[model samples]
Target: MLKIRIIPTILFNNFKLVKGISFDSWRTVGSIMQAVKIYNLREVDELIVMDISATNNKSKVDLDLVNEIANETFMPLTVGGGIKSIEDVSNLLEAGADKVSINTSTFNNDFFVKEASKMFGRQCIVASVDYKIIDKEIVIFSNSGKVSQKVKFIDHIKKMEALGAGEIILTSINLDGTMKGYDIETLSKASANVEIPIIASGGAGKLKDFTDAVKNTDVSALAAASIYHFTNTTPRDVKIYLNSEKIPVRIN
Candidate 1:
């Protein structure tokens, strides 16, 4: 069954779980290990742990944290941060991460994606791209969306796909944290152009947002933070709502 995956995205800064806007002003939420326990009970489809400050902070992969969380959780896990080479990918996978997400490295290291795909297989290599609307068109952003690369969203997605990225996690810098809804218009553009699975990120305020993203954009999955972290919602609830809407979703 082609079910929509309800994933909880956890951001870490300075080795602490935090949440913020456009990837700044991060406020520590909890211990990464503690967050993992909560999500395990919720039975989420998958969990994404990203150390947004690692690149800027110049820290290595939190292998101890990764090992702890992986040991506790039963769902699929993806870890990203300061991943610069194949050795980093190998270390993360060996530490028990199911997948690795690459962003900033792709611009200068185009071959990293292909090399990682060859080493870990395409399914384990996720190309995560951040974008913001410029001149009414979605443009790619790097350095945590602080600078615009000015690359059209569609062009970037095509390049990542051609580079052997197994899947793409597309986030809208403009809509991120707004809770207005997803950038479905932009998401649809990527879906129409790419055959790989697209994970829609940002601007999810309620359950309806998930339904709308999948039904409207045909994105393979929907990811959100504030909606799941600060609200009373759970992945199970999102799946139940999507199922009610006649969308396939795994229920725990």
Candidate 2:
């Protein structure tokens, strides 16, 4: 059996590492290189670095900086934000990213996902989705959660899978950065509808939050930013806790 992966997502505003609540009011936590070295020491399973300011600023994904960080870490590195075409995907991969995530462009023109998957295997493509609840219904938000897809969340996941996404990263806007826990109901529903892997992201506050998410749903992996950035918990400790709770995890 495959052990569950504990992924730490790193957000970048330019080159500075930052954390925010519900995707707003970002405060710089430290430099990206420093954070990368720390996670490397902790032996994190994977790292996701998203350039939060890229899309809104109409700039490209910071490929140079990503290339620099990818050289520093040994874990699987995935980078996202401002990816518009197949060339961008090639550039990120060439920069040493194991996989590339596309959000706004995928929602706006889903063919990008299909074409990227076709060009460079589905395993290299990740569909990153950010969403919020409105009127007791889940709504898909894109462009870093600033715009709405106006579609049901599960439907979007199915569409992404059909378009050949290797995995889906589902983030809950209301629960993001709140450190409450994973959004189990939404995550469960989304995971059940897709055959591909679902990586649970956002709202992981404590060790129980991770256990609670895996127990409630079959997430392939759980990801967080604030808790890992602001707290003293290490990946090794989390694995120990999960193992003690009888959950399958990879001990580092």
lDDT (tens digit, per residue) of candidate 2 on 1-252: 799999989999878889999999899999998989888887888999899989888888777888888888898999998999999999999988999989999867859999999999999999999999888899888888899887777788999999999999999999999999999999999988999999999899899999999999989999988887789887777889999999999886
Residues 1-252, model 1: lDDT tens digits: 877888999988777888777666667777877888989987888999998877666677788888988998788998898888898999999999999999888886879998999878999999999988877877787767766785667888999998889989998877777778998898898899999999999999898988889888879989898787778887788889989999998986
Residues forming the 10-long window of minimal summed lDDT in candidate 1? 143-152
Error of 2 at 13 (Å): 0.5
After best superposition, candidate 2 residue 109: deviation in angstroms?
1.2
Q: Which candidate is the best by TM-score?
A: 2
**lDDT, residue 83, candidate 1:** 88
